[model samples]
Target chain A: MPEVSFVESLRMTLREEMQKDPLVMLIGEDIGRYGGIFGVTKGLLEEFGPYRVRNTPISESAIIGSALGAAMTGIRTIAEIMYIDFTTCAMDQIVNQVAKIRYMSGGKMKIPLVIRTQCGGGRGNAAQHSQSLEALFFHIPGLKVVMPSTPYDARGLLKASIHDDNPVIFIEHKLLYATKGYVPEEEYIIPLGQAEIKKKGREVTIITFSYMVWKTLRAAQQLEKEGVDVEVVDLRTLYPLDLETILQSVRKTNRALIVHEGCRRNGIGAEIACRIQEEAFDYLDAPVERVAAMDVPIPYSEPLEKAVIPDEEDIIQGVKRVLSRN
Target chain B: MKEDHQIWLELYRMMVKIRRFETLTGELFAAGKIPGFIHLSIGQEASSVGVCSTLRPEDYITTTHRGHGHVIAKGGDVKRMFAELMGRSTGYCKGKGGSMHIADFSLGILGANGVVAGGFPIIVGAGLSIKLRGTDQVAVCFFGDGASNRGPFHEALNMASIWKLPILFVCENNQFASTTSFHYSTSVKSVAQRSIAYGIPGRSVDGNDILEVREAALEAVERARKGEGPTLIENRTYRLRGHFEGDPQRYRTKEEVENFLEKDPIKRFQEFLKNEKILNEEMDRQIWQAIDSELTDAIRFAEKSPYPQPMEALRDLYAEDVDPLFQRSLA
Candidate 1:
């Protein structure tokens, strides 16, 4: 295993998949000669040729629609939406068309397309760019939503998503691209919907995903020093959530704290909390404490933004609250 | 003359199949057997048949809400299409896509769009793929005159023109966006005129006249195959029925609808075939009979098909191989 950046892992996964299947191609804004906005597709254009590494117009609708066309036509298209917030421009294509195509046609047509985009707060991206809309996609039955926390998970899960028959939405956090992690060389796939136990413990189970997973791990480390052992569970995929793993972790700890970057109301954490109370009620000693962004839209100001989104301190406080309930 | 006769007979066959399909769809819709809105392609049969006839199975066709005609003309499986409308498990989309979103890529017909001008940008992308891959395939985007005002139409045409993508922008000027006539929404007299801004060849043909539409589409398809970039074609047609089934036509005169109905595409094409002395009435009758039988069989198949099972509702929602979330349970 080599220490690779999260973006490199993503690139490696794409490179390998593109080589394996000629039908696999890249489509998105700035994905061609200029590489991606974040350089995740850097050097891929030259490696795969212009036909394979396509740079689509700024129209998100076109990018997504074209991806659907290609996917339906037996091409596996990995289309980038630039940023998750820009998804608003192409919601009709995403929701009404791509998500519905497979089910509507009675499985006669399946869009084997992967829509890759960057999400979550951190880049001073303000309200539009910083929001986490995994829950919105989760509500859509036909879509598979995957959000990986580590380079290894990012590469493996993305590789699996590319080869899958149905449409998969891969959401990457803006700040996690540079984060380094151990990723094994050669091809691998981290199956979607399976929760990864980043660290094992007993005092409390911290359930989080995306960038918050890293924050939760940091809180776990700090708590360990305080003799309060905490278990951190990273939900890499949101839609087909691994409730069994979550409940198993909750059963082991008897206390649970749900955390996510999205708004608390109807957020991913809220869904997890409800599920825990439904299935893991007997295991929970205290109520499931959720560490989530406030109900208000993500603001631009640094302090206001910090106040809205979850941080390590928030996770720490949530952990303490869960333990104090005992 | 014999060659012309054969083509005319084939065209007639396509018309009969589409007509029967559309009529059956209307009946099914009334019976509540079809899900979602069904935009009948009854009057615009010639426009779809003419354009799709000029393209290959590999060549692409993007459709609008009025898409059954295009699908049939492009050789899509009618039974599957009807099954889709009925939301059956055997439908092309496994019952997910109802009447408004039928698609068959094997026949080169892209999915029908529910959004106005939604197929415009996609056709450009398909053309980009064809041209980039050096394939002779060309993409045809079928939209209504109302879609001309949509942002995707302008964006796609402009980009396709600039990039020299092999796309045929076919605007079926049905004259109405639901209730509003094209004249009311569009600033331009002819939607074809907008092609001048993109610097691509632009032409307007009588949509009801099958020969004229075929000639226009043939030239555009040839030009696209020759790497001459995209062409904008405005086929001026009319909507005989209301926008949807229940729409009360307060906007347009009944006389206008009646007048357009008088020049029925199948009738006009049949008359043209007769005047050219290429095909006899007997041959036309035989072709129509075969298509009608086919349509009847398709309807029967759809009626017998079962609705998608509730347990399988989650299946194919995401691509089976890549969707990591669903497979997590297996692990």
Candidate 2:
């Protein structure tokens, strides 16, 4: 077993995948000689050469559109948008073209494409750079959105997404890139849409994903000492949500709390909470609760940014609120 | 003649076929047989047939909303295309994609994009794929003058130029982008001249002349095959029909359309074929008859084809098995 940082795990997987399959190519801004802005694709260009590790111009639409074209035409592509906020520049290509091409073509086209981007509010990067937009992509029917919380999850889920013969939006958190976790040296793939129960308990179920998973896990540990048992379920994939796992956890605990780093309004929590109520309403001993970022533009100030996004305290309070409903 | 008489007649036949297909499509839409809207390249047959004449079946092309001529020229099956237009299950996209999104991957025709300049970037990817695969397959992107104003067009051109991707950007400057005239909407006087900004060779051609379009496309396609890079070609033509069927067309006058009717590509190619002795009235009549019968059978096939079940909408949305969550949410 090897303990690797989230960014290292991603780089290792990309290198291994590129070595295994020549068709697997990386394209984005500064992904080649400059590596990536987050250093996730560092040294990959030197390893794979220029053609496979392409450095693209600041053309988001072209970056995504070319990825779509190349993927369908027998080249698997990993298109990197430097930031999730910038994805709006190429919204038509991502939403109209990449997402719908397979279905629109009657399943005649195979889009082995991965759009890797990062989003969160902890970086103090302000409104344009720090907002989480997984909800927008999740709303698209044809795309698969995966947001991993740990190095282990990131490595395994990325491998599955790249090989999945469909378009995948592989979302990463900027804050979690340096976080280290145990990863086995042997190759193993974590299937998308499969939720992992990070910590199991019986009192309350805390369901979250991406960076929120870490905060929820810590809250669960503290709640254990406070005589309140808590369960944590990390939903690695957002679109084809692991409803079964979520429902099972909620059914077992008879209480549910959804947490995410995105805005509370129409965020990932809204959909997850709705699904829980729809599926496990009878099993729930209390109403479902959600802890999410405030519905405001992420400010550049550190205190304001921290206050806007959900934290461990928010998750802890959300758990107490759900438990108090009984 | 360097080219055979049969090749000349074949090009004329393709142009006529596109002309007939577009005319029939317009008629059917007016007759209320077709569902959804359609954009026709009624007067741009020479640009499509001429450029496509230089491409192999394995080469790639990404077209625009006004893409029927390009698709037909690129060897798309008329029966499946008509079936798709009629929203039949036997169509190219199983009725999911209509006239604006028809695609035939077997013939290397990437789907026609519904967006104005959506195909530019996608065709760049196709060219990159060709280079990676180590093949000489060039990718042609067919767009309108209006599309040149889009961000993707600029981005795609810059990328294709730097990478030296095997791409042919055929701009069908039909003088209009829907209601807005190309002259008013485009900043440049000619779309071809803008190519110098991206360091690519470009030229404008008389889009009504099939020989001229074909000769320019031949040289460009050769450059792409030899890994030289992309070329921008502005085909100066006119949209004989309105942007879409049933358009009020208040933007342009009837006299304006009638003026371009004299310069119709199909008619011009027919005259050239007649002068070259490659075709006569009888041969032209036979070609039309053959195409007409084929279109008639396609209509019959589409009419007989079953409409997809409502639940079938959920199918093919994903390459993987339909997620239970998807079904639950829809339910």
Candidate 3:
């Protein structure tokens, strides 16, 4: 199998889905002839026709609302918000309509809708376009959150999310689009709510997901060089989090450090920390340390951005602190 | 609009069904058997029945908070609708959607929306799908005078007009949006007047007269099916009941309600049918008996149905394919 970039994988998944299901459709701003801001949807309008790959007006509420309506009426729709920050404009539709419809309707309704948006601050997109909001979605009960860290997982998960019966909030990292991983050209699926253990270790376990997964893995490699042998766990799905896997890892290592790109205050790390403290506290040798981006907006300046966001060195330091505490 | 014997008789049957359904629903709400707020389509039944009667079974409809009458006219199952209001597992939305949001997709009654003007954009999307699939299906959106001001309503109508989407926007101007009279709320004298801005044909009809409402809705739907874009039908009617079950009509007068009731759609239909010699006592009795039994049975089914399990609440928020989904993906 040839290595495929994450962006290419997403494009292929969309192509395959569009070809298979006549009801499958795409809608977003500049998604038609413009091929999307990221070019992941290049040539879709020409290949599938404009109707199937529509370019919607710049109305997030309408974009999300229309997608909800279309999905309710038998069209399997994938609506894209250009950036994660803009989803705030459509919070009511996303949280109330999309998240609550199935439960509020007693499961008689199916919203086969996928809302794909990008998150990250490395490019100095600053506060508006850079914050990770997976925790906010994870707080909602009905929505499933997918944040893939690799090209293989991104492609496989996008295909799976498209066909899933529920509404999926798929978050793509701005930094990972160009990243490449070995992906089969043919059909595949990466199951949601399953964590992948990136590097096996007997020392403290590092529970992380999304763009921070790679950061922690690099940190783990450095930790191993220092004889710490830190285990790095990547949680592929955030909503129905694989608590069992995380618990098992914690039981084995008896020490842990949770990491996320989202700000630390009331972030996903807090929830994961609370869960660990509850389920595996007796087995742990030290309190769980969390390595998250400091609780603030991502800055425009490179050094300021680095200070606010967590990197491999920060993950390495977090591991050392957890090990010393043990 | 004067109707012949047959049309009057049909109108009487529909109006009675709507009136009886709402009366029963109001009673259920008072009895605490129904959860969530109820927006009755009581006095405005003519608008729902009239326009819905014009639609083919395959043609689509999107409705508003006050949606029961429209659903009934579009052939939704009465028992399932009731069951849904009671939060039973057998309801139209499997007990998820209550009074304000009941729907039966098989009958082409897309779910009634809770948000003001929320149905417009969705109706446009549905219309787009219809056009794309090369189906002659025309989608009708029955909203209220209040929804005319919503941004989505304007966006949807403009897009529909430009694309010539097969849609009929039926604005049931029932005078008040929860006690806020249209006169005080809307800037335009007539809701249909707004259509000129979108470049779609516009018309106003006596919503109290089912025949008039039917004729207008039908003409607009026909035009849409002919690939002529959307039409705005402002059916001027009045709200017979308070906005929801518990609203005290401190905003309106008893004289106003009485005045609207004198021209009640059901009574009007009955008079028209009797004068035209189409209504017999036997036909009246049969229609009442049929609707009554349906209502009674539907209530029973809803009462007997189970409440949803707590765990099932986790399902259906997102579409899924081969992935194990949130549990595994997060793991």
Q: Give the winner by DockQ.
A: 2
State the lDDT of candidate 1 residue by residue for A236-318, as single tens digits.
Answer: 98867888899999999999999899898988877788889988798889999988899998899998998888888898898
Per-candidate clashes come to 29, 0, 35
**Model 2: chain A TM-score against the true structure:** 0.98
What is the C-alpha lDDT profile of model 2 across A201-291, one tens digit per residue?
9999888999998888888888888999998999999867889899888888899999998898998888888888887889988888989
lDDT of each: 0.84, 0.91, 0.84
On a 0 to 100 scale, what is the lDDT of residue A80 in model 2?
98
- Over B8-27, each residue of candidate 3 has an lDDT whose tens digit, in order, gives 66767878888998999899
For model 2, which pairs clash? none
DockQ of each: 0.42, 0.78, 0.40
Model 3 residue B177 distance off true place after TM-score fit, in angstroms: 2.4
The better candidate by lDDT, 2 or 3, is 2
Candidate 1 interface RMSD value: 2.9
Q: List the TM-score for candidate 1's chain B.
A: 0.95
User: After superposing candidate 1, which stretches have Cα over 4 Å from the reference?
Assistant: B31-36, B83-95, B131-133, B279-290, B304-312, B319-331
Chain B, per-candidate TM-score: 0.95, 0.97, 0.94
TM-score of each: 0.93, 0.98, 0.92
Candidate 2 residue-wise lDDT, B1-331, digit = tens: 4467878888988988888898899989999989889898989999999999999999999999999888899999998998899888899999999998999999999989999999998999998899888999999999999999999999999999999999999999999999899878878899999999999999999998989999999999999999999999999999988888989999988889998999988888888778978888898899999988888888788888887777668767777647435435432
